[model samples]
Target: MLGDMTASTTPATSARLRTEIPGPASRALQERRAATVAAGVSSVLPVYVTSASGGLLTDADGNTLIDLGSGIAVTNVGHAAPAVVDRVREQAERFAHTCFMVTPYEGYVAVCEALAELTPGDFAKRSALFNSGAEAVENAVKIARVATGRQAVVVFDHAYHGRTNLTMALTARSVPYKHGFGPFAPEVYRVPGSYPYRDGLTGEQAAAAALDRVDKQVGGDSVAAVVIEPIQGEGGFVEPAPGFLPALSRWCSEQGAVFVADEVQTGFCRTGDWFASEHEDVVPDLVATAKGIAGGLPLAAVTGRADLLDAVPPGGLGGTYGGNPIACAAALGAIETLRTRDLAAAARRIGETALPRLRALADETGIIGDVRGRGAMLAAEFVRPGTDEPDPDVTRRVAAACHQAGVVVLTCGTHGNVVRLLPPLVLPDDLLDEGLSVLDRAVRAEAGR
Candidate 1:
């Protein structure tokens, strides 16, 4: 187990900087990486991690950085969690892989059962595992199309599904994710989504506006699926207005279209609930989950109404490494941790501790245009004082400063002006407070500039 591991390898909980941000060792690795790795593949912080535990990441230079990003919301139970590590080690000792499709396995079926029990919706549900969020999303689209026999798929503004061809086309952002990657999948449409900060429209009003647009443009009957992130992830932690999700779900049911909640980033108790869609009491016809699932192992799933998934022909949906034994074991252990630790409540506690501090920072620094999110999934949108215009320059400077000061922070948004915080659920209150202090100082310094 993680706790039983040697203490010497795991750095102390607090941030400890022994040298500059990207010290000599990290710089050398960066140079080696630059020579081989693709230029397009970038990192938030260039400090190569040597080890991590709880909420701290130790770099090659021996600097222990406070981890607020949680590897982009993947390590919700925290890095090197005891349960997950132990399970993976035990599974590896038993056997690695025989390919689930070829020989089959109990772990895969067990994970599916767990997912069916945990995911929202009271009706009979089934799941198909995949290797990543993008794969799961693409499969969801396939299932919806097969189930509905329709061609058009509708996504929302400021939404991020994934980077695969179909998902990239479904995505709204064009600069980095979608640029130079087209001739993307056809029949994917984009519609207006509620942005409470920018539009100031109530949930009903936003839903009405979006539905009206769909009626005029694609006609709801033609759309097979309507995919959205309950709380947008890469597009920033943009939580839609309160009634928007339920309204959309109702519209989909009325039109015979599948409502897909892309909870890849907001699932698995990251948003103080098993799923963010539950916050609005909206039960989706389909759901895509990854990131926080499987305790940092490569695993994703498309779980939803049994009818929709069952419509797919046998052997139509599967992959060799979809639910590898080790990954399945990790997921079981991670789920156990989530239940025993009550990490959903832990997420709520994180929000209670961080949101007030962030709101206060927004009050103190006029440049912070908006502070919004739920649970540990939170963000502060930076903008020009007294105006809604995004300030990406300030966002970049603040994130860079936080990195130098030994705090791992991530910036996102279609315009790149939002600083998102996704700290691990296992983060101690003291460590969380310290990370927030660094963020507050960084934002203050940037605001002054």
Candidate 2:
């Protein structure tokens, strides 16, 4: 029979490397995964995780590693948060799924209500739940097209929407996400977005250039939606310069196109705000949210202007398990944790603590080209010293060293030379500092090499 698992399985707060990162147990699991799992599915680290709590992930080989990526910004409130777990257990005991489309439930409605309240824009708002961020983005696009009666959609450069067919078309990267997955959806256009680090253009300048392209190529009037990430995620933690997002939003408003903010990675207190749009006081016509929503449960939502969402027919905008009851319960718990714990402030604190350290590291090592991002969603871009040329080799080496030392870091960017950090907001200060120290050592070692 099962005994008390918590006492035996709970990992310590600090990182403890029991063996080499992908120790014998993890290597064995990797062999099994190679046999069974598809090659397409990839993992950042070879260390197979058995359990995770707070800011630590316990691997199969009895190693506890500092969780800097937060499962790619999905665990803002931390892993296995008590409130979320309790709520999930309660909801599961009562009812796991009724298929909201078949028989509607209160949890779904409650989550919608929460989204409407939390998402930016003071006007009357509504939401539709989905299983993933890509689905939410797709639904938002559908709503935009239906409302505006237009076919063309505009996405910015360096955007990373998702992996689905339509989202793959929306995405800008060509190597992995969109390489073999071609013959993409039609009516999607890409324009220049403000990359202050690389372009050296002010936000307004970048917006004007992008708008010029839209007018010349896509025709602003024919555009149904102007979709963008307030802060790009997989394309790098590339936050647009000041005034860029606001200008694009204004242009969309003038052109009769819905401005959609894809906040899949930046929402839910990850960026020191309810949504990244709030940072610029830019209210989007529609917002796509997921990742940190629901404390790691599969929940994504499109929340925005009520009129646009309601324009669709009654039968539109729903899926079989869009808002599973258990997921909804967990979302409620996660939302409560955000509000009561003031995790938004926690995110800000993380920024305050880490940004200065990262900047100092950049100063010490010229290879660290740029350090940017808000709140806990921070990144360090790597380039060859004394030149703008990207050095992905240095980035990979640093990440590998950090991994060996028990800090789980992630690399991203269009050029693949950026190391991004997304530590959970709930992490203790000492553990966060420890993780930073490991990162610092890794970067220093790479620079020396």
Candidate 3:
């Protein structure tokens, strides 16, 4: 479906740069945006995108850039996917919003059913939809607190939940996401997360350290929820050590704390699994999902064990635009596309193609301190040569080089030294390889410098 529709708008085979990275048209538009757009909302690339399809984003100056960052892993099915577009159009024509709380709709129930079925749990499950990942996470916290009758919320270092006041307290980073926005929600505790590259500890060891900290600092019984990203997104795409998640889950179960998986970025098919928690065979008590769920639409959900979710009384959990009809329709189509296309397998294939290249690049370039991730959601942590110190400057240079070469990549991590690549699952191998080649050159050039 995407192949047919995107053929006309984007390049059929390769990236085409008619002008510079941010050509004249894009620069002019940026100037206009500076006058009206909020200063806090920043964009990675200077180019103004006119249209995007498949893996290519065409800017105002008509430069087609190969997308290695899928709108922060939002367009896993590809931008303007036919399945999503068609369903959106059909639903919008029928009706857009009726406020699910006021008037229930079939689409919302259908999405909830889909979540119950698809999410990683064999037991009876329930779900509540929200407008964004932040809302989903906030609601998840609410459910956990109410269900457990506890006050403390446990999160980890190098973690990112969302931008809400509660989530900001949950988030580890403070500069941009949490800076100057205090006094945040109370009863939030931060613990150590497994970072294999930096810590070099085995999964069990990492888990023990984290659990020990929680027991001493927060007290295990007081924690309502222990929220974590199966594969951390903003905190540098850090995939916890193999046994770390399971260990934490077991601890949570023992302590009567809800094991919450913030799969907002790692959910859907981004991490080569329906949910990244599945990779470790860990079934969380609650899962916060968004980003890729609705094929780029603004939709999020808190799906989990029915008991925990049902703990909330009627009218206790809902929002006006939580499950808007159009977004629900888009989610249904997107879920269908994922199932029919087996995009999870596609994500695995992407990792098969990307991980090797990235690892090889890490070996070749001393600047790359580590290469780690699952499936298409991969990242390379840049570091100073001969030392493990993060090198954000070099990371910026490498990303800038790739952007100039007509390949779109992104940088992340707490230290701002990780370059992440989130290519669409439908991205052709040739296009992917081409983008990787550009990345290779960029890293190589930066290493030489």
Q: Which 10 residues in a row give candidate 1 its minimum summed lDDT?
A: 1-10
1-449: candidate 2 lDDT, tens digit per residue: 01112333444768887677788999999999999999999988999898999999988977888999999999999999999999999999999898998998999999999998898878999999999999999999999999999999999888999989999999999989999878999999999999999999999999999999999998989999999999999888998999999999999989999999999999999999989999989999999998899999999999999999999999898988899899999999999999999999999999999999999999998889999999999999999999889899999999998888889999999999999999999999999999999999899888887
Q: Which pairs clash in model 3?
A: none
Quickly count the clashes in candidate 1.
Answer: 0
Model 1 Cα lDDT, one tens digit per residue, 33-143: 999999999988899999999899988978888999999999999999999999999999999999998998899999999999999988999999999999999999999
Clashing pairs in 2: none
Give the TM-scores of the predictions, in the order they appear.
0.97, 0.97, 0.97
Candidate 3 residue lDDT tens string, 201-276: 9999999999999999989989999999999999999988889999999999999999999999999999899999
Candidate 1: regions farther than 4 A off: 1-10
> What's the lDDT for all of these models?
0.93, 0.92, 0.92
